[model samples]
Target: MYERARYWFDNTLARGVTALIGWLAVACLAVVIPVSALLVWTDERAPDTAWAKTAAVWRSVGQTLRLGGEVGSPLRVILSVLLALMALFYVSTIVGLITTAITEELIALRRGHSTVLESGHTVLLGWSDQIFTVVAELVAANANQPRSAIAILADRDVTEMEEELRSEVGDTGRTRVICRNGRPTDPAALTRVSPATADVVLVLPRDHPQEDAEIVKNLLALRTAVDDSRVRTVAVVRDAHCRLAAELAAGPDAVVLEIDDVTARLVAQCVRQPGLSVVYQELLDFAGDEFYVVDAPDQAGRVFAEVLRACPTSSVVGVAGMDGTLRLNPPATSVLSQGDRLVVIAQDDDTTVTTHEPAAFDESVMANRPPAAARPERVLLLGWNRRARHIVRHLSGHVAAGSVLHVVAHGSESLAAEVRAAAQAAPALTVTFGPGDPTLPGTVNEVDLSAHDGVIVLGPDHGPGQASPDDRTLVTLLLLRDRERTSGVPVRVVTEMTDDRNRVLAPAGAGADFIVSGKLVGLLMAQISQNWHLAALFGELLAPQGNAIHLKPAGDYVRPGHRASFATIVEAASRRGECALGYRTRGIARAGNDHEVRINPAKAEVRYWGADDEVIVMAER
Candidate 1:
């Protein structure tokens, strides 16, 4: 019985520690009021001390029994001890409640439950490996701003996200990154990040099978919460088929990017013309030159061709019509109307200015060399992955009618079926498949490496539930380099890697065009996040059905061994219905090195042209 009473007392005391404020108040009063009553009743100096002694004793006893307090006699002393113990218990309980409340608040903060109160901030919705790149780019873009903030909303712990960002992105000068934990598709969760007042909202596609659908849902939720028409939202969709649906859900103004289509088009373009990827990186990445739209009112009545020569530091590639139409590489005769913006490529937006004094064009150096004729060639593909199908589809459209393609990879009949379907869609190109492990040197030697005009190494599947897909790709590249060295055959190699870090480890002297898929996607996402309108510009540039970046032989614009000014070359390309941005010299196709390919060069500068040198242009063909 005694042990049971002790257990009950301990449990009751623990319950009291976590009790509500009202219960604690009751406990305090139960000790204080009773103690006061007992002290008053036990007073020896009574009105009728002699006769009322017995009555006072009885009243004190009743009060002491009802409430724990001090009284006269031995019974009163025992009650006093009990009352002191009760008071101590009440104090401990209050302290425990306060401590518990503080601990819970800290836990909530760590969990990213708090609301973010920031204005004119960039809101990034979702978390993935791409967040680091996005954050780093934003930091660089906002370097001149006095203060900048990037609020992130993802279903992750705040501390973890912050730590990872700090580890990856390092220092972010004046930009502050705020993390909030919540489901991106939830309206209430979206509200916590203050999406309505945000300058831009970037929705990163999750790495999952249903990423496209999830992106659509997140866009819809963000749209519903951010009623402000000024708020710009950009999202990435993995599948091209889901782009229209995502765009519809995100509203007419929202920017949606198709990852597979963009990557596939880039691969196709890069394979045909080496070092073209570097040109794109220069225009897309924040570290280098980027595209900007600025009002050129002074040159309102000037022709597009004249505007190209007017900007000595900036390359005037296109014009954005006043009616919200973006025309890249328009005809030279097309006039820039009032209120129309010029699409320029420059180191910074401030550098895209028009010079009143135009550079002198050397008409003596201009030559009319005809464009090269299309020729059928043989191509080899090493390994296959998710992007293999899209690459084949885009390849068929770019290659000549009778071009042949050979795909070699270690796969069952399912992959062969898919490749066959891709081939059927593009009847102009013939594709054949062979089963072999592309990573092994012996397997790669079975094919005639010298016979193929170009070799494309596709990034292989890492493994079941594996992350790094570039390991096998690197091995294949090494073996290919060995084979080429042994056979003394020179072939244009364009390899795809999943991670950007692995690009640096590629075999030296291989002269392969390394296409880092994630890095490219991240750059595109970052560019779109900064300026939502650029999404339309990028969509048109990367799409297979629109005007894309091309490397035409310089001979088409000027005669070989002739010295010509850039202004004359620009005029020559304009005559051919193409916009010339810069030129890529022969025997210089280094990746990430912009010295060989000069973009937005000075119009007055003269250079000797070669027949093999190519002029970078934006055209349909």
Candidate 2:
């Protein structure tokens, strides 16, 4: 019987607010009535009448419950209690309303539904691993500004994004990082970031099969939400086929970077010129000196050759004409007229000042040696991926006549058409394909490493099992490093990894190069977003038809066993019809040392020259 009554009471209590309120009233009355009766009975001075004492107890209960307690006739006492209960109800309702309103507002804020009112801010839409690199670069780029902000909107928890960003990108200084949660494709949600007034908007692609479609959707959504056409919009697409769609959706003003194309060109370039990756990395990262297009109106009507010696602190690599024609490493006779912008490599925009004083150099230290012969190269490709074919085509453009390329991948036969086309287009390259799994035992040694001038290692294009693409790439990289140790022959190997974190595990040889696709592409997009002119400038730099960056022996320009001023090296490069940007010091190729590449050093700075220390220059090799 007791258990049944307890169960009934528990069930009633669980019936929610009304039941809770009833129980609360009952509990208060139970304690107040007992205490009130006890006080009335134990009082030293009594009312001296039973009816009066009962009335006093009732009045005490009314006082404890905050209802009017009156010692009067029944009708008047009842009216007072009724009025008091009415006032209490009104007060409780107001308190409840205030608390609920405040709670709702806090929830909305936590949901990231508030609109941002700042102008000239950067907005990053979508979430990816590249976001960390991109945000870090943006912070560095805006370090000179007094106040700036980077707003991020993605379909993620607002607190989660903020916590992760704080952990990844610490000490933003005056720059603020704001996060909002919503689908990038939702036009209504886009207003939360106020993209219409944003200085620049970067649409980052996801790591999914439908990433291209997602990018297009985001562009269209941004189009609907952002009516202002002056805002800079930059995005990336992995596949070349989706480039046109992405561009169209982003409108005519947006700059869209193709991942496969950029990675292929970089891999092709790195395999040919070792340490070029480090050079490009320095140029692409905003933490160091990078490409900048600034107007130098005072120095108009000067020839390109004379302009080369104009800047003591910066390097002049190209010029963008007012007519939209960009000339990188233009002819010495080319003139920079009024309204023309100089494309310089410098630490900052304001620091690209040109001095009148001629730079000093020791001309006696110049090497004055003949150029090395361009022999045909035998390149062994250890793996194939979605970018393998494009890499081969780009390799053809840089190699000499009669160059040989043998592809040993798990399914190289499937890439026969691409190999044949690349070979047919260049005629100089003889390409072959054969089936081989790089992860299998004895497979790497079977493809003799000593026979090739350079090796290209491409991660799997797709993950087919428990192991990921980067895992396979790591396995292959381990094999190559082991072979190099046993054979004692340094092999020039360019490795492609999907994730940047895996780079630490790969053995670092002087010739072993890495091109982290996500990070590099993120840096490129960030650069172009900041300045659209860089799109054309980088295109010219990476294009096969024009002069690209190269790393040649320092002995080519300066004699070994002597310290030489950079001005002397610049003069030597000028004589060779090239622009000397910087140099990689000798003995910097061992593991854990990444400070080899230095660009745009002061012309007066002196360095102890070595035959092996390569000079980084923009040249047509």
Candidate 3:
């Protein structure tokens, strides 16, 4: 009975302020009334009559409880008690109002209910693993601008978003990151971030396939929230089928990048050239040489051949005419008339200066030997996943006829059917699927490592499961590396990982390449977010139908043991209808050296051309 009473009392105390006040008053009265009566009775000169003594005890209790205790007639005592009660009621009401006001204000702050009044800010909608990189890149891009701000609106808690961004992105420096709590798909909720007034709004995509529809809805909600059609918007969609819907909702000015197409293109390119991802990382980031459109008035009447050497600190890749059409690696005779912008690759916009002095080179040391013709190739794939079909199709498009791709994975009927469909889609190449577990040593060692030109290792989708996708990929990499060590064989290996931490933990060697799923998308989004023109530039660059970045033999341009300036290599490539960006040294990519890949070298910088060195260029082949 006592425990039950205590439990009931505890529940009542938790009810609210009214219950707490009632309990407090009962506690005070139980002790104060009895003590007051005892004091009055103990006094000798208290009251002679019984009625007088009772009234005196009541007066003492009233005075002790801070109610008015009048030592007069009954009417006077009753009026004083009434006045005291009114005063207590007024004070308690005022106190309750103030406490409520403070509590509501705190809750409003915690919920991020206030509207942002800043103009020309960047607005981000939705949340994903890409947020950290996007925020970090925004911080870097806004480092020079004063009082720049990035407002993020999502369904996550404001505090959680702030703390995670701080922990992942480190110091944001001058750029302020404001987080708001709301669903991005709701137009009413989207208004809190002021997307209409924002300079650019980015709609981030999540990992789930169903979230693609939500992203499209976000774009549509943005349409309802922002009346202005001029506001620039960038969105990402995982499925290619959803790209058209997202783009239509985003309007003509928006840029919608399909992640699957881009990922497939990158993986296909890396499979052929192990060192290509390194070049792309430098291109897509702000820290290194990237595409820039700058005026070249000085090269007005010069042919595109001479314009190649017009900049000492930059590489001229193409031109953008007044009509806004991009021309990458045009004919050698193409003229760079005044008013046409030069699409050059440089470390910064200011560095694309025209050099009046011509660069000197040793034409005597130039090699006239053309590159060997292309031949049929073979590829060995160790695993399969959602990206495998796209990889196979894009790889088939890049390789010559009679090329072969051998896939080894689980031989389940459903898996076999998927591989068979992908194989049937690529008519020019032959694809064979072998059933086995790639992580086992015998499965990898059974293949002839010397016959295949390259090997691709892909893991399953990353999430909660028996084991992580990264763990399986790393196991295969270790087995491949071990095979190379024991059998004295060398093979180019391209690995796909789901996590950045595990990507770094994977073993690295001369013929190994690592591609992180989210990191690449984050970098691409950041690049396009900073400069919208890059959207078209990257679109054309990654497409298989146009000119692409290629790493070619330095011996094909400049003979081995011959010294030449970068300008001479540029001229050599210009003769072949290509633009030479930079060169990579052989075996000089040790510590402190970034894999020996250098971009945007000065035109006058001379070096001894080695046979093993490769010249980076934009060419059709």
Candidate 4:
């Protein structure tokens, strides 16, 4: 009873203060009404006591009422004012209710309970075009597991993200999607995606350069924040140097993929042979013949090539021996022993037991081929860029002693020290520096094309405010083509290209081969969209593990006017302990087409026996 009385007293005091102010206003009006009635009654009096006093009082009251005249219409004005105040009170209450509700929802979002999903979900961190591809693949991978969830963490509105996923990813087969709004770089923000409960954590590259390094930094934050190492981590790195850094950041169990270097290697292979990307697509794609690892029965007398023909929808491309030797296209008639695991290619693992012919062999012709030319003795580097050092480092292992590599570029003064350092470990690769404009005169003349056995054109390094690399390459090719008019000496050329669309700018007559990096990146993206396991398979192939792609003598595979089919070439490679899939045929005039080389018979239709023509093969000792 006391508490209720106190509440009533406080409320009455507040209202009493308001009412007192209202009463003061009303009392002022009482003087005005009486003064007006007196003025009407005393219209006849002038200077008498009653008349003067009445006039004085009337004047004073008139002045007072004029000064404070918000009083005469008391009842109507008070009612109207009360109604206006009540309307304002109701409007304020409605606005307060709406604001409180919105704040509660926002708080719920930050706490993560509003959208936190269950365990066993796949968590994706960061944002990019790669994200769309990754989610599509995850959806496909989760087709067998019902109720699988995919959660994405990005600094974007959740609804906007969901809309994009729906439009770009289409139907996510048996996978539910959850989006959380947060920055990936922040550890606390990462908690919204529930990284500890996730099955796989895919760290994506940022949308710009230095993306891999940024991702590595984010991984470090995640390691400290994500408390669980059992979760498999897969990350895409943009640079080769960052691969080790990312591995360390993501820990030993994490799989850090260096996509740029892999893309460059693929570009190099496709340049060596047209349609090579198509072959890789067929091998790596889920919709086509995929790579599989199957154990073959112990046969002490069987051959590796013959074992390849023994699988269904599967081709034996390689063999893993008991001693861990990975031999691809191993020697024909070479006896396969027990514990040899055949590295076969098939549509899937289920098609590894069908039988087929290994190859039709004629031993006399295979035994008579001569050895390949000595290691590239003199080489020419046509430009300066980041990839130039990598190429030089790789060449160090292959080039023999007494090999000289000349460096020709405008920035030799600045880049000479770096080039010298790269060649420091390789004493055989001596550096000779020359200063000349890549787009101007007297550059190709300085480095005699006829003297060097090989010429490697380094594409322009991408930097702020720099011209396109393709334009510079086209100018260099034109100059080289002009210089080779008199000297018919063979100079094998390999060029780096920044853009695939600009590859057609190079002159076809220069006898130069080119590597288009963009197309290789596109092809990789296309392949991974269908299958995820291919990432590791191609990584092992490009690495120096076992049988890598090598250029071989054309006569070792096929002869001039032999009318040999692709099958015959594959057979010859089987005999030579190499797996041949394609070749560079000479004598074909490459007329206006940039994609294929036309091998015209009349001009130079000899057996493609040159150091320049790289026969696509898997090499084995």
Candidate 5:
């Protein structure tokens, strides 16, 4: 009965009840006057004396005022009329608002663009920084289809959602975004966005502890709401151990992306190649060229070098097979089957070619030399974070044996031991934990960073309610630069930045590279949002299997008086079985100038040669 009453209230009575109630109120008022007059006449004829009659008239006048009039005399009658008019005005305004809302909803329904209490659309559960990124990607992915809609259901104000979208992502193009205000975990609230007809559901982890558990609960609710096995469901989980629980809750076909593993991998890559996160940025962002599947002509058992030279339009980075297996920059001699497709970097399908060279590199000019001599190392790890362990682990991989890692921080007991164990496990790196304020005096000097070859500052975690990490990073950079000027030591500093806002804060002369964590996640979601295969491609690049970004010595590509050309560098790197994509120059001595790390270098710059240019190379493992 309650359900039926609600249905009637929503469907039928909700529209016309206001007007009916207004008319009924008017009728009640119209009948009250006659009834009051009859009663007063009857009372006066039956028993009232002069004083009693006067008291009875006053009583009737008071009753009239209470009903809708003024308190005294004939002016009360005018007051009553005025009160009725005011009530009518209020009723009209309320009725108009309800009517407008209902009308808008009806029109939207008729156009098949919206629905109430759930219907066909992709429902994004929860709210976080990843929400905007998720929406933008979903829109772009479904852009080619006609009238594909995305419903965002979160425990946030719908108007705030709209405003955030406009400010962050302008012109959603052809995709329509509908915001539903409610908790995503509640079944009734979830119904507001219609989960039954949803093509896919993405349950994002909240930015809090027990986020993994929250995802599991949301998944369980989603399963109950939609029994359809065909609907693709994806969730984000914080811990590796929780991944199994989330996957079990989401079922076999559903994907539960483990946040820690992905983040760790990114941090590891950044440690190896300081600006690798930028590659992810350009690939994931909509403004630049993205990864693509371009068909390379029958290489006829040719080498990867020849195949790379063969692809004219797109920049070939990897290849995908019919069996869904992928290989990044597979060896030149690796046979290409007819079913295999080359993965290239291009803006779109139309912007690519099958067989052509990306400006020829003169082979004669290519110079291959022995590796540079090792220098004594001083490394400073400023601050502490979740990724700090992973960074230390990967950093230990490349350094010479017996190299010292000075960890300077207001050390936490839990993280301190973890860092110590990780570094001890590494064969080459010797770990030392020290207590010092990153933004304080005598802290950097006490560590003797002047003797250090490089310093790495780990950004703070965005976990739970932690303070913003950017300011600490900026202060550390400032302190380092001030000390470097006094000491005159060229200490290579690589730092982690949590927010993009702090990018300009560090002086370029601080001799450091910055890694923005949130931006990396944003870029990842953006890529997978547009093309599903990109997730796999990104995984391959980030993984330790092949052609990872490496910083090779400058002597491998250019000499002291050589005319600079990207083609020459590419040829040199190719001779070493690597792809030379870009370089970071050691030429910028003054702080705050361009750090001179160009990823996709222009082919025509003749005066850009430098002996200290670190070649960005991609090679088979």
Candidate 6:
């Protein structure tokens, strides 16, 4: 019996303090009511009347009930004191319970329990380091709208995500960003963001080994949860082989980008032609001129060349068919069918207007076109990384048969083996590797830098026992610049930087072309998020088999040192089965100046072209 009583006491005390207080209040009430009733019955304040005893008992009970009201006897006073103590205990217990409940609810709120009621907002379905860039771009894109919102759903702490966004993207202008904690692949979690009502969905690939698989699963989940076909979806898949699976899961209406393929093609193009990445960045990012699809009913039956002359503010680059076909720089004689859209490059979507007045063309200065030269190239590659193999393979596709590529890196044997494996698919060009550290001046001097036609510097991948990747790249760039200054060699240098901020710190006179990986991906994703049709457009432009952007000699189209109108240049390029977009003049190309490489210059304006000036064109070869 004693052991049972002890167990009962321990269990009762182990109950929460609030529960103990609740039990104490009940016990106090039980004792206080009976004690007050007994004191009322034995009160000696009765008068010599028939109802005098009943009245005295009632008065005693009332005094005790009022929590220590005026008492007439010693017994009544003691009961009142006990009743007051009980009331204090009851009030304290109620306050404690209320405080505990409030704390728990606050914690739940911090964990993201509230549901979003926003409609027509952009929804970001995953999280990574690229989120900052994506958010900043979206904010700028939505700056003119009075009310814009971006909701992020990720499997992370809500408060932490908010704090990181606040630190990275300070002011959002009129845009509001909301964060929720949930697994993107879970259907139940997706409902919290109201995907059915969203304007668009962007699935960011997570930073993990199984990132592609996770992205496919998330895309499937989003497809299953939303029934609206009007809402557009964009996703990124890292592996090329997994792109088919992701596309199948996302359906035909969705856009799925292959990260490796795009990056490889971009690096290949940039390495071959310097300043190409800058043009791509301007086209992809919203801060500058971007591609927009606009209806041109007035020119439905007009030829493609006429459409180019009609748009003064915008540059007509391509045509988008109603059947979802994108033709960039198609044949000039191709007729624009009814219901077709013109893919034009403009500062804003609303700024793509067609002017009725046509600019006069100078047919007198137009000259016969010359055949493209097939000169052998001697290229030098500094350092090695994961993208080096892709760069080499793509470079092989663009160079002549007798061109040679020399690779200088730390692990020469391993890099050579990898290059050999990559080159087996394309055996036209020869590749060789040498052992040396390109960042050191002595090692750089050993290799004859003046002999190469172009130099491509790759950022270090591992950075083991060395500075950061960007720091190492900067050192190599400085060394190469010094070499060029000493030798007076005019070798074009193309560099890869992991961070975008480091691009600003590079030497000004070096004339190096910077390709920032993260920022480039972020810009592409942002552009596609706004318009899903751009995915296929960019894919076709970057693919090796389709029409690609090229910088050819301006002398090929017009006479050297002769003044010719831009319209005459366009007409000349059309004769060669190509489309002329812009030109880069000799001694005029700068790092950050966009006008130095002018795109969509006035057709009537006559300008003298130098012998070494390059004309930017879109061609299949």
On TM-score, who's better, 5 or 6? 6
Sort every candidate by lDDT, greatest first. Answer: 2, 3, 1, 6, 5, 4
**What lDDT does each candidate get?**
0.81, 0.85, 0.85, 0.62, 0.66, 0.78
Better of 1 and 6 by TM-score: 1
**What lDDT tens digits, residue by residue, belong to model 2 across residues 81-124?**
89998999999999999999999999899889899888999999
**For residues 309-369, what per-residue lDDT tens digits would candidate 6 score against the true structure?**
7776677878899998988888889999999999877888888777665545666666676
Q: Candidate 3, residue 546: CA error in Å?
A: 0.7
Q: Candidate 4: lDDT of 41?
A: 59
Model 4, residue 564: C-alpha shift (Å): 5.8
Itemize residue pairs with steric clashes in candidate 6. none
Q: Which ranking of candidates, highest TM-score first?
A: 2, 3, 1, 6, 5, 4
Per-residue CA lDDT of model 5 for 234-351, tens digit only, reads 6777666688888888886466666655665655555445555555555566665667776655654556666665554345667788787878766655777877777766766557
Positional deviation of 503 in candidate 3, in angstroms? 1.2
| Error in Å for residue 439 of model 4 | 3.4
Kindly list the per-residue Cα lDDT of model 3 for residues 94-174, writing each as its tens digit.
999999999999889778778988899999999988888788877877777888999999998888888999899999999
Best by TM-score: 2
How far in Å is the alpha carbon of 411 misplaced in model 3? 4.5
Each candidate's number of clashing pairs is 0, 0, 0, 9, 13, 0
Worst 10 residues of 4 by lDDT: 597-606
Q: What's the TM-score of every candidate structure?
A: 0.83, 0.88, 0.87, 0.62, 0.73, 0.82
lDDT score, residue 278, model 2? 84
Tell me the lDDT of model 4 at 68: 24
For every candidate in turn, the CA RMSD to the true structure comes to 8.0, 3.5, 4.6, 13.8, 10.6, 8.1
Estimate, for each residue in 88-115, the C-alpha lDDT of model 1 and write its tens digit.
6798899999999999999998888788
